[model samples]
Each structure stands twice: as C-alpha cells, then as structure tokens.
Target chain A: MRLFISFILCVISIAKVQADSFVVDKVYHPYVLPNEQEFEWRLFSRQTDEGNKLAQHIAYGFALSERVMFEAYILGERNENDSDDYGLKSYEAEVRWMLTEQGELWADWGALFELEKQHDSNDWEATAALLFEKEIGKTSLTMNFFMVYEWGDNSRESMKNEFRLQYRYRFLPQLQPAIELYTGHNYLGIGPAFMGIQRFDRQKQLKWEMGFIVGFNGNNKDNALRVAIEYEF
Target chain B: MFKWKVNITSCLLLFSCAVFAQRPEFVLEIKDHLFYPAEIHIPKNKKVKLVIYNYDATPEEFDSFDLNREKVIFPHRKSIIFIGPLPEGRYSFFGEYHPNTAKGVVIVDDTTTVNQPLEESSHVD
Candidate 1:
C-alpha cells in the first residue's frame, strides 16, 4: 500500500512539471507566437535560493510568411537577485521562425530558426540556431543547436555552438512530466523545466501557463523556478 | 509639374502596396441563434483571416474540424482568427460555447471566389 501511494505521488508531481512546455514536440521558444502576430505581454516571477525576483517580457509576434512567425522581446529589469542588483542588466530579445512541420505514425517533427542575444552582454551580440523537435506517443522531445558570433567584433571568427534537449511525457490534460538538458559554448549542464497551462471556463481565450527550472553546471549553479501568467491579450 | 507627377505616382504605389499586403479578411457575427452569412467564400490556397464578433455578450469559441484552427471569442469582444491555404473543401465550424447558436462553413475553392455563400445558382447572375 505504501509503495503504491508513493508511486502515485511521484507521478502527480512529474505531471504538474510538464505542463509548462510540452504540447507539440517543438522547443517552443520561451517567447514566440506560433501563428498570428498579435501583441502579447507576459510577466514572470521566480524564486531561487537567493531571493524572490520578477521580470517582464513584452513582445510582439506576427507571421512574416505563410509558415514563418517572427517575435521580438525586451526583457525588463531582472532585479531582486544579489548579482542582478549590483549593476544594470541588459535586456534580451529572441526571434524564432518555424520552418516546417513533419510527422510519422508515432513520431512528429518540426524545424525552427531562433536568434538570441548571447552572453547576456549586448543586444548586438546574437546567436542563430536550428531547432528540431520530434515525438513518439505521449513522449515529446526537442533538440536545439545554435552558433554565436559577435556583431562588430569577429576577431575570433570562431563559431560557438550550443545544444539543448528536452523530453516530456504528457499524462494528464494540460500537464506533463519534463526534463530539459542544456549545453553550450560558454556554459554546460542539465536542468529540469516545468510547464503547466489551463484554459478558462466555456472559452479558451484566457490561457494560464507557468514554468519551473532548476539548473546546475560544473562551475557555478543556477537553480531557479519561474511562474508566469498570460491572458492571451 | 514633373515633381507633382512623381509625388502622385509614389502615393499610388504606396497605396497599392498597403492594400495588397493585408491578409484576406472575413467577418463572422452571431445573430438569431445562427452565424450571419451562414458561409464564408474565400480564395483558395490563401490566408483567410477572420474577425469573430460575438455581439450577444456571451463567451464563444470558433471551432472548425476541416480548417484545423480554433479561437475563443469572448463576450462582446472581437476575436481574430487566421486560417490557411487549405485545398478545396467544405470546412464546417461552430461555436463551442454556443454550438447550437453559431455554426457555419468555410469553403476554400479557387473556382468559387465569392466572399458570401449566396449559392452556386445565384452566382450565375
């Protein structure tokens, strides 16, 4: 009886964590519109061992082509943390374009183009990557590999690439069990990210989503959890 | 006089671009327990964007089995819906909140370019 109860509890926890990100086997950029270029506003707050911190992501997304969507975000103050409070933090923006959609009997695939500011240093510094996603049954997976280059300073001319992979299992409606792996040019490690989304009564116009992440590397560690709410405005 | 002509030509070009750049549009309004217009005729293989106006102040979701898209139009607010260049077919849709009240079809046919579903016989005029 005890073992059965423990198993049930574990399953519930995993299911809740998966709700924030896995639905279509795609590495859904933390901030992008899949179809329509509507103006979307999102506010995120998370708690780490350091303190309670909040950040806002204001973005606009619209389809550039029949199959392509472009989105840009300017991350406002990520203050509240010991490290962030010391100096001014630069705003970050990411633009992702979905290329194509593919699927098989039990598997599906999607391709995307993602550009993000690198090193969190300057807006000019950008990285471009090809993101691929595939899934089998309730298990969804994603792999994103990107190459970075300095805008004005191409002295090194060397391309720094990074890869991120996530696996999620959907057990309940709007809930899943998730595990995310990330490794890149300047940093390396793995973490857990969660996704949860719920629709309002009668209409799905109002959707609420939240995400949790805990990451650790060989060097310094970052174990943070994020919660965000959006009203499809 | 030559400069005025140049200015006039530029204005015309800009206007053309603006008109052509916008997506194809449709409007679906709920009235008398049914979708006004009953059907939407759109250009085949093109983007069919729609504005769903639920004037009744009741929440509703536009759902289409053939169009492969869905959107919830809140009470009294207009919801923008975008559908794609699907092959010629009759796509049926309905209101999830009030399925009995709102229902319609989106016919994607290149040969039938009429924006209103006034029947094939009527188009003969």
Candidate 2:
C-alpha cells in the first residue's frame, strides 16, 4: 500500500511540470467487454499563436477475448500554415489488457501499449500506459499514466511521460458529464467534457464525446477542441 | 525477452482456463420487453453463467451498473455473459431500450442454491 501511494505521488509530481503544448486526447477506462468490436473516429483541433492545427483518427478495434483488445488507427493532420499539405500522417496499433476484475479490487487496473509509425518517414514512437479506474457512488474516477519513447532517423531519440485524468458523473445511461485533465511535457489542460450513448438493437450502440480544453500557460493562447464518435457492436 | 514472453503466455493461458471453466448456468427469457423471472438467486462468491434468450422482434441491451455487465441480446437470439464471484447483495439490471418494463434483479446469497426455481412473477412495462 505504501508503495502504491509513493507511485501515485511520483506520477502526480511528474505531471506538475510547466505548460505550453496541447496534447489533450482520450481518457480511457479499464473495462473491456467480451467479443466486442467497434469503429471509432476522433477529431482534435487546436488554435495557437502559430495557427490552427487539426488531426483526425479513424480506428477499428476488436476484442481478442474477455480481457484483451486490439485496435488499429489511421491518422491524418492538416496545418493551416502548411498550405494544404494535408494527408495521411501516421499509422498506429494498440493493445489493451484488463488486468483486474471489475469491483473485485480496490481499483480496476489495465494496461495499454501502442506503436505508431510516421508516414513517408522513419519516425516511430511507442507508448506503454497504466490505466486505473474506481467507481464512487454515482461518479467514476479514471487515470492514465503513459511512458512514451520516440526514435527514428527523422526524430530525436527521447523519452517522455504524460498523464490524463477524468472524473465523470453517471447521471443516466445515455448522458454523462465529466471533467478532464491532461499533462505532458510543456502541456497542461483542463476542461469540461460530455459523453453520451445511443443504443440500438443487440450489442450495437453509438457513443459520442465533445470537449473544449484550455492551456494554463499565460505566454501562449493555446486551446483545443476535441470530438469523438464510436460505433460498437 | 524470450523468457518474459513465455511467462506472460503461460499466465494468460492459466487465466483463460479459469474463466472458461464450466460454471453454474441460469437462463433468463425476454419477451415483449419484460423479463420472465423478475429476480434470480445465485450463490455468492462464485462465478456463474447467464444466458439471456430474447423472443421479442426488437433487440435489447441488458445493462447492470452494479454488476458492471452489459450486453446486447438480439431479437430471437441468445446471448451469454458471466457475472458474480460477488458478495451477498441485490444487483438490478434493465433493458436499455425498455427501461420501464424490462427490469430484473440478481440476488446473490450465500445460502442460495444453484439454478434455484424461477419465481412466477413477470414484470412488464
């Protein structure tokens, strides 16, 4: 228990570093339904002093079993300053493992591993993350701690760490409100998010999320808008 | 690295074996957006299998926040899910499409027998 507390403190301290960059993205939960499959699309747009940058990701995910899932994504980005040089940016593959049974532990535990390769370049990045979630009454708290390593001929060989946290209220099955926080090197953002689900016939549902995040640093006017839609069957 | 891979694979095999092992089975029928047995009793602290048969023409999603289980049961089809190894308590579930009528409760009790006789009460909305 002491070790766990120390580890959490360490992660928080790492996240307390200064802010400038915007890396606000999805906050994952620690549950995987058996034999589940999903198709998802996400959009992230950021407005900064440099210009507006937009990225979109399309992904397909499927469960291998009750405890494991795999997903692949195609990413694209367009920068306003780049003058229409927008196309495929990267390809990514990810795996998630549910490490603990729900409600059987103090907190549910999971792990995520991701590998990404840049298009038309020898730049690659890998990330390993720990996912934790706990339910308290009508609310749920979730956290992701990520360790990322970047390498390749076109990129600097470096290692980085990041964290994302979400606190959500379960008002109803269809609609939920949440507060999300993201922290990385030179990136700190907090915002309100809303997510909802619309269920169709047997094992099919559509989920949607929207969030607007603002950076904390005063030196730069940095903010981001993110939207995601998922179809699960 | 090879040793680590082997160790991980072994652990996963063991876990999967435990999960797929045969367990007590219970059946719940859905017709006209109502559960036939409004409540079920299962042994506490033991994993059990639940097979839901949907006779309605429209699909329904079986959802339970207390049990942390959710699945979609297609019309005229059956779906399976595992629940339990839980403490003694009452867990409620409802059909997402017809929350008013398609509702049921799982009663986990230490003294309850496996596959207990179904109660005659049928709840409809």
Candidate 3:
C-alpha cells in the first residue's frame, strides 16, 4: 500500500508539469469493489476557438466495504496559450456509496460525495452527486446529477448544478460504444464515448474509457477529448 | 455522547438481526474461470442467499448488469450475496475477470409445482 501511494504521488507530480482544458469524468456503472484497491489515471484535452487546454488526474482508491469506496485525486491543468508549464491545481477526496443492490429495485442507485481544495487559492469546493444506472437488453444507461458549492477566495458560494447522461450499447464484452451529454449552467457538450475491459488474469483487469465532445453553444468549449484508464487489483 | 452511543447500539443490533436471519442457500462454483450450473432457478418473490466459491487460483468479479450486482471473489475464497423477491425473469451474470467463459443466469419462476413432478396414478391399465 505504501508503494502504491508513492507511485500515485510521483505520477501526479509528473502530470502537473503540463496540462489546460477541463472535462468531467464520465460514469458507466455504479458498482464498488469489496475490500480491494484500485488505481486510475485520466487525461483530458479541451479545444476552443481561443486556445487548447489539457489536464491530468491521478487517483488512489480502495473499497472499504461492499457498498463504499474512498478515493483521493491530484488534479493539474495548463492552457496551450499560456506558459508551457503546468503545476498541481488542486486535491480532491471522494467517496462513492452504492445505495442498492442490482435488480433489487426499480433502478439501481448510488451516490458520490467530493471535496476539493485549490492549491494557489483558499477556494474549496464540495460536490454531491446522485448516480443512476439501468440495463435493458444489450443497452445500459447511466446518469449523474451533481450540485456543487464553492467557497473562500474567489468562491462563488452559490450552488451550481450539472447533469451527465450516457447511453451505451454493449456490442461485445471488450467493447461498448456510447453517447454522452454534459450540461451545466453555461455549457453544453455532446460526444461519443467508448468503454472496454480486458481481463489479463483472474486476479487483475484493465478497464478504459475514451470520448470526444463538441460544444453545442457559443459559451462552451469547441472540442474536448477525455481518456481514462483503471487498473484493479 | 448518550445519543451517539444509543445510535451505535441500535445499528449493531440491526446488523446482528440481519446476520441471523435464515434464508435458503445456493452454491455456485467457479472453476477454470467457468461457472458450473450456469443457470439457477429460484422461486419468484422470494429472497435467496447465493454463496460463490472460486476454486481458481485467481480472483474473479461476478458482474451482472441486468441484476445490478457485482462482487469480487478472491482466489480459494467464498463470498455470499443476497438477492431477492424479484419479478419473474432471467438475469444474466458473468465473471468480469474472465468474460469469455464465465457466464451464468438466474431464472426466477413463479410456478410453485415447477420443481416437483406430478404423481400419476393408474388403476386398471
């Protein structure tokens, strides 16, 4: 565990050296492992008429119970038009709770709680999210509703709500094509996403997701791409 | 402090009660990344306990998007999951760690006489 922590720290420091635009992480399911550890890395790039931005996030997580998972993330971002240097922007702690067992209700549900602190400023943000997932035949739908509160220096203190929707077709066990939509106060994005899982052995597996988004309105970023890789052990 | 203690005590009692509740048990075995008895039939609208034993040296994640259930079974270990009182239908599951071969289903039947054979009486034939 100590070695894993060190690795996470090292990756985060390296990722901060360069990055800019921001993209929201997408969810495909709402299941948490029981008594296992997971490591995840996500890279996102956003392109607009003005400039391009890139960001990197590294997280270390563990399943505390069958229904609960806890994680910490290091976030870094940089803009293409700005200096070529990127530094750590913030730190985040998150907890995910699986609210109901699969097939136990009309719809499977979960929730997420997160707290983030910015590095250069005293700004802190708290987010609460509801996660819903349902499977019908070969298709699965997942949605997230998020409410955030930011405070302190340059803090908006006001609540900001966001919604994300994903519809995926399970074409194969290793490949699933998806469509994603993200909507917020002044931003709207629609994109194509793909997810897959590869089993290396009985004890370990690699899961990945990648997507590209095009902003629909003038206030939104013109283009964005997000990629995430997760390793479970 | 008094309120906190009472809350904790209540939680413990509830947990113990749940643990002691008796439910019909079924076993699913994982060998070579394949599930034996790939289809399980249980009466509809009744909760049941499923005990999964992974005989393989490697761990496997039992995933059923249709069932909304997922659990990681460690090598040579057993895990128990309770699923319930569901409508009549077929719920499919697979081992996430070995999706190619580990697949199974849960069939909830509403018919009570489904598992029992009817007795036929012959008089003069």
User: Best TM-score goes to which candidate?
Assistant: 2
lDDT of 1 by residue, A26-128 (tens): 2354223333444445554544455656655566656565446666665554555755453333344455554532321122233444444523454444556
* Candidate 2 CAPRI-style tier: incorrect
Candidate 2 chain A TM-score vs. reference chain A: 0.93
Can you write out model 2's per-residue Cα lDDT over B1-125, one digit (the tens) per residue?
99999999999999999866757778899999999798988899787878777889987878986776776676787777677677889999999779889999999997545564333333222
Best by DockQ: 3
How does residue A47 of candidate 1 score in lDDT?
Answer: 46
In candidate 2, the residue pairs with backbone N, CA or C atoms under 3 Å apart (3 or more residues apart, or in different chains) clash, namely A20-A186, A203-B72
Residue A46 of candidate 2: its Cα lDDT? 86
What lDDT score is found at residue A224 in candidate 2? 88
Regions of candidate 2 where Cα sits further than 4 Å from its true position: A1-10, A16-22, A80-83, B1-37, B40-62, B65-68, B71-91, B95-102, B106-125
lDDT per residue, candidate 2, A55-144, as tens digits?
Answer: 999999999986899999999999865857778999999999999866555588999999999999999999999999987656889999
Kindly list the per-residue Cα lDDT of model 3 for residues B16-81, writing each as its tens digit: 998656455666889999998899887787777677878889878888755656788888877766
RMSD of 3: 12.9
Off by over 4 Å in 3: A1-23, A219-221, B1-38, B41-60, B63-69, B73-125
TM-score for candidate 1: 0.47
Model 1, span B7-81: residue lDDT tens: 999999999998776666677786544677788887776766676666765556676544535555555666566
- Better model by TM-score, 1 or 2? 2
| lDDT (Cα, tens digit) per residue for candidate 3, span A178-223 | 9997766555678999988876665477889999988766564578
